[model samples]
Target chain A: MYVIVSGAGSLGSALAASLVAAGHEVFVIDPDAALLARAQEDLGSVGRAGYASSVAVLTEAGAARAQIFVAVTPSDEENLAACQLAKRVLQTPRTVALANQPDNVRLFETVGVDAVVSKIDVLIANLAGSLPAHPLLKLMPVAAGSREVVGIKIPALSVAVGRAVREISLPYGSMVILVVSADGKVQTGQPDTVLQAEDEVIAVAPADAAETLWEALTELR
Target chain B: MNVIIAGAGRAGAALAARLAEGGHRVTVIDPDRRTFDALPRPRIDSGEITVIEGDGASNDVLEKAGIQEAGLFIAVAEQDVRNGLLAQKAKLIYRVKRVICSVKDEYLSAIYRGAGIETVNPAQMEIEQVMAMLGGV
Candidate 1:
């Protein structure tokens, strides 16, 4: 797949390297020539030192033919604008962006950004994993953040513990894909499989259904 | 009408003052408190206009500036990209009826304009003014 990555920052560089290693053709753009040069060494000479939002820069980087256009610039505005230019003007099939602000997530997704990765949201979710308020940790967002894969831990004092997985009412558009036992055994989540304390259930769910699913599995009946 | 002007630069402050004089509730949001100096003191002191010292690109700042009830949002921040992004948020997220982004770069302005957001390109406007002065060339 042909990928156009905007920004040669740490995240962009890592992603470009991974995409290149995966055998995908990658072109990176950044206003910082030094950073772009450093990133180019890992990928190839396919780097442009310019704003990705520039039509000329994107044209030179072959954005029109790119299968994926991902912007991870420090500026959320730059990321969003570059993705918008790529998706709308260049007709790139998929445009992903790093939303620097947690609030920009909804705006970015609604503005037709194919996917949005909010570091703030991830950091909060990570930190909140230890907090009782956040029972499920979002592993990844799919379908432009409308849905996500979450890890829901079964608490020792939970109502669903020892109950069949099928008996727990997972919300609409949510289902347990896998369950990892306390002994670190990973297995497919079968409908009849009984839940156990300390079991880490990995589930795919609509983003809004997280609270309901978490409560259903963790709360006392 | 309720108006929120992002950036208290000369343009933003002047616009805020003029809008407030027009009887519109105006709020000027900027990251630098120093920039708020551009705003007329009497207007801010009298509560004819409000000033918020915060990043106008941020959602919190916009919310604090009363974006929920704003009818118009103007982004005249230093960076073209920041202005475009804020304008989009005000229009799409906050559901503001009108949004205008001041983008100096004509190319960037055109791109934002293509996306259905209104934009005023100072550079392009200057060129147009010069061309008009040159008498229909």
Candidate 2:
């Protein structure tokens, strides 16, 4: 597969290296000559030192042949513009972006980027997971970001401590897939499977219902 | 009419003042506190125009600026993508009735305009003026 990568930042270089290692054709573009040269030398991918959003630069870089356009520029606007240009102008089949701000993931998706990964979202999820307070960890986005895979840990004071999966009114659109207890026992979530405090629940839920499901399982009642 | 103007640059501040002068409520939002100095002091002092120092693209900031009550949103940030994306977000999320963004690049401007948002390219507008000066060349 041919992949066009915009920006030669740490994330961009790592992605190019991985794609090259996977035997995919890679073309990297960036305005910074030093970064571009390093990425090109290390990854052996075609490199262009120019603005990612420039039509002339993108066209000259053979953007039309890109199977996927990965835009991880430091500037969110630049990333969005480059991905949009790749999708609209070059007809790239898929466009992925790294939103600098966690909030921009939704904007990027709504504006037609095929996928958006936010570094802040990941960091926040990791940080929130480390806290003692009940916080749902977003495992990943699925179903074009309309759905989310979440990990929730039932706390001791929660009302769901001893309730069966069917007994708890999980959010309307959420489904529990599996449960792992603190002592390392795993249980496939069935209607009869009762939840225990300190048990981690892995579930898929409509993104909008994730919070409600978290509250349902982890709320201190 | 309630208008939300993103980017407290000269254009945004001037536009906000003009709108507030016409008896319309105006809110100006920008991430930089220094840029707020450009705002019309009298309107800001009288509370006819509200000023907020926060990321104009953020939903919290926009809602705090009363985007729900806004009939129009104008994004004139230095970056075209910032202006266009914020404009789209404001329009789609808050259901703002009208949105206008300043896109410096003509190609990017066309792309945004094609997405059902109004875009004004200062460079393109300047070029048109220059062409008209040459007798419609």
Candidate 3:
């Protein structure tokens, strides 16, 4: 997906990184130079820095081709304004704005923004704090509704360390280990390779199995 | 400024390639000798970047990589926790001026900052981007 994010704050930068990792073409529009620099450093090859509120910058950032245009600046007014510019000037199909204040969320919807995400709504959901809920939506409420995969360090004392991966009993679900970081390098899989004390394992399991998997992995200890 | 990367993993390799293209002295550190195979040795060398396979977390490795004079320190290894630890170590232990760490977890990224370290969480960033793309927000 080709996306233009109009904010380089925490939320904007986070979104930019996620999209880039998912192999999407991303352009970030931020008024803050430091945030843009940090976003560029983090996303590397897939990031384009721009001042998105301006029509020239949006045009140059290819907003016309954007599948999704996000206005996530801290200010609700700015976000709404950016969304308006995106819809009217750039002819962007879908524009979303982050309403830092809940009061402006309804206003955003009335103003024709495709979506308005309020800070309070986001915060309440994130308060649950379930690890591995959704790797992508770390602090968002979406994790509870979506499947999750998590990376964990296999403690030497865990029951999972000694047995073969297939033989190791786990919660009812499909399981796959994507990568194992041992001695500071990533290895995709080694069936015979024993899970050692410090090995970092990226495990894929159902989101609901998070607690169960954690217990099962640590039960033998 | 002369920069030395502590790991030659994907991020490290990419950074080296970019910094080298920009005409900066880059030296990569990794214990796995195989990383040298994946890295463009001649291109990096021609661009004035050096690759030394060794444990960058160790003082010996850093000393050999000229850590004493390095202005920038980037720890892009596999471990987020270790990256933060390395950043702290680089700042306090080695006194490196600029240190950047790569973390995958968003929660940990927020927590790691308390240790006086800067972090880049690619996964969290991806999440934010994907959310924007999918939800149009």
Candidate 4:
């Protein structure tokens, strides 16, 4: 889908990366050159950037043809106006306005926006569940699921805990087994080495082969 | 007198209604159609106010909102980035006098001021108000 995003803040940048990774044509609208440059670098080959003030940004974003228009700027008012402009003026089919103020959601419904995403609400909802033990590992790209990266700690009781890479069949579709540190260091493509207890392994597998890989790697059911 | 407000949220509507009470033409652009109905009771009935639910960043909306002839342009959005963009367009492109932007973050507020846009921050104001009550001001 062709998408146009207004702003290049944390949320905007993350959303752009997520969508681009999903193979969508994304156009970013931001006036800050510094932020734009950072976004360009972060998004790399998957996306394009334009100054928010330029007529070319809107024209090239193909506002009329865009499948989704997102106004995720921090300002509730700016998001509303941008979304309104995209819909009522640019004739974009669907528009989502980010309503920062929970109380102002009523304004969203009353104002006729297609949808309103409440960041506060999302954070609140997430907190209701047991905060995942590995909070930093939250929200991996779903497409990455094709490769199916799984994190596991080797235990001393396991028979293969001290075995070398060539000693075990390992998991099915486990082409790459990377050891990531609690401190975030990564050692990839383990060719030959003794696996130690407490060592973390990130194994990748094809979608249908994850269970097989898990069983082969770990003794626990 | 014509006024163009870039955001259709509460503050923008309040300002529009206040301006309209003085008999100025007011147009507010917001993505939410509900903003039109969500406006304070007085602002909605002002008859002189026109609420166009859509983006203020769009040149078409800017033009339709009469940005060219606008006496004042106000951008009071929740996001500093959007407010700054609309301010730049209003001042540099449309040549509107008295471009007022509402910035929530002090860091962004400083940046917006450095970029030569007049800014008001409700969050800062509330903070200051609280501080004043506590004798911190």
Candidate 5:
């Protein structure tokens, strides 16, 4: 596969190196000559030293023929612009962007970028997972920023442990999808299904309402 | 009308001031608060013009500037790429009625214009004027 990676920043260079090692044709675009030269030497791929969002730069980087285009610039606007240019102008089959701001994940989608990965959101999720009091784990965003899939491990002292699924007053637009017992027995969430301690519940809810759902399910009295 | 102008640079600040003077509520966003010092103060006849110190390209900043209710959205950031993206977001995401951007890069201006956003490219306009004068057109 031919890939065009915009920005010779750490993320961009790493992606280019991995793609090159996989025997894929890769090209990197960066405005900084020093960074471009380093990326070219490290990844052994074509390097175009110019603004990635520029039509001339993209054309010179063979964006038209590239199967995939990924923008990993530090600026969300730059990433979005480069990806849009790749998709709209160059007609790249797939365009992905690393959204610097978590809020930009949906914005990137609205602008027609094929995919958006929010590193900050992932980092936040990881950080959230390390907190013992908050057992909610953000699985992934769904339906842009509107909804998300989340996992929560019910605590022993939690108010939800002894309650039925229907008894819990979950936030609006939140639904418990599935539950897994401590022994790893998976069960579909039903109104009559009683919650148990250590039960891992996977739920879908509006992204903004995830915390509310978490508090409802795991908050200890 | 509610107007949100991203970037408190010379062009953005000037546009914001003019719009505010016309009795349109204006909000200008920039990373540097000091940029607002260059803008004209609000007069008795002018509507409120708020200066926000934040990244113009940020969705939070745009929302804080009342982008959802904005009748006009303009991005005149120093970076053409930032302006293009912000203009697209204003039109597509926020559903602003009118979106305009100042793109210094002629190539980027063409792309933004093709995407249905109005773009003013000073460099392109200057080049065209120069060509017209030299060619006697």
Candidate 6:
């Protein structure tokens, strides 16, 4: 696959290296000539030193023939504009943008970018996972951002410790999909499945209802 | 009229001053408070012009700027992406009667226009002005 990567910064350079190592054709664009020179030397890919949103720069980078275009600039506007140019003008099949702000993810999607990766959201999720007493760990977002897969650890003193799956009243739009016992046994969640202490439950629920689901699973008797 | 301007830079400050002079309530938002220094001194002293230091792209900032009640929302931020996003939020989320943005890139201006938002392209406007000066149109 032919790929065009904008912004030749740390993230963009790293992605270009990986793509080149995978035997894919890679082209990198950046306004900094030094960064583009380094990317050319290290990744053995074509590099262009100019604004990625410029038609001349994109055409020189072979955007029209590239299968995928990725914009990883620090500026959300630049990234979005580059992706828009690549998608709308160059007719690239796929375009991805790195959203610096978490809130810009939805905006990027609404503007027709094929994918948006938000560093802020990733950092927040990592922070949530590192907390000592976080009851719910966000596994990943699914179903186009409407739902999320989460992991919950059932504490021994919780009210749900010995209750069957059917006995717990999950919040609207939430469901327990899998349960892994403390003894390393894995079972699909079913109406008759009984909860046990320290069992890790994996569930899917509406993104907004995750907290409600966690409280339901960890509430005290 | 209630107007919200999402940048306190040269263009935003000038527009806010003009609107305030016309007896319209103008609120200007920017992440840097120092940018407000560029705005002209308020003549009315009736608090017709307000300054807010916050990210215009944020919903909280927009709400605090009274975007829900704004009749006009203008995003003249330096970044095209931020302006486009804020304008979309004002039009789609806040349901403002009118939303417009200043775009440096002509292609981005076209994209914004295609998305049903109004855009002012300074670069294109400059070119048109030069053409008119040379008697080309």
Better of 2 and 3 by TM-score: 2
TM-score of each: 0.74, 0.75, 0.37, 0.40, 0.72, 0.72
Q: Order the candidate numbers by TM-score, best to worst.
A: 2, 1, 6, 5, 4, 3
Clashing pairs in 2: none
- TM-score, candidate 2, is 0.75
Better of 3 and 5 by TM-score: 5
lDDT of 1 by residue, A1-221 (tens): 99999989999999999999999999999999999999998778498999998888999999999999999999898898899888877899999999888878998998899999998866665664555742578899999999998888887667898998889888998988899999999989889888888889988888999778888888743
Please give, for residues A95-153, the per-residue lDDT of candidate 3 as tens digits: 98897766456546755789888888777546533333222211222346465576666
Alpha-carbon deviation at A187 in model 1, angstroms = 28
Best by DockQ: 1
Candidate 1 docking class = medium
lDDT (10s digit) by residue, model 5, range A110-130: 767888899986676566456
Please identify which of the two predictions, 2 or 4, would achieve the higher TM-score against the true structure.
2
List model 2 lDDT by residue over B15-115, tens digit each: 88789989999998888889878877888899998889898877789889999988999998888878877887887667788889898877787887776
Root mean square deviation (Cα) for candidate 6: 11.0
Task: Say which docking band candidate 4 falls in.
Answer: incorrect
Q: What's the residue-level lDDT of A29 in candidate 4?
A: 77
Model 6 lDDT on a 0 to 1 scale: 0.86
> Each candidate's lDDT (Cα)?
0.87, 0.87, 0.71, 0.70, 0.85, 0.86
Winner by DockQ between candidate 5 and candidate 1: 1
Q: Residue B110's C-alpha lDDT in candidate 4?
A: 55
Q: Lowest lDDT 10-mer window, candidate 4 chain A?
A: A132-141
lDDT of 3 by residue, B1-137 (tens): 88988778888888988887787888888888777666777776575888887756556777889888988989888776446545655766667878888877444454445545678887878889999889875
Docking class of 3: incorrect
Clashing pairs in 6: none
**Interface RMSD of structure candidate 6 (Å):** 2.2
Sorted by DockQ, highest first, which candidate order results? 1, 5, 6, 2, 4, 3
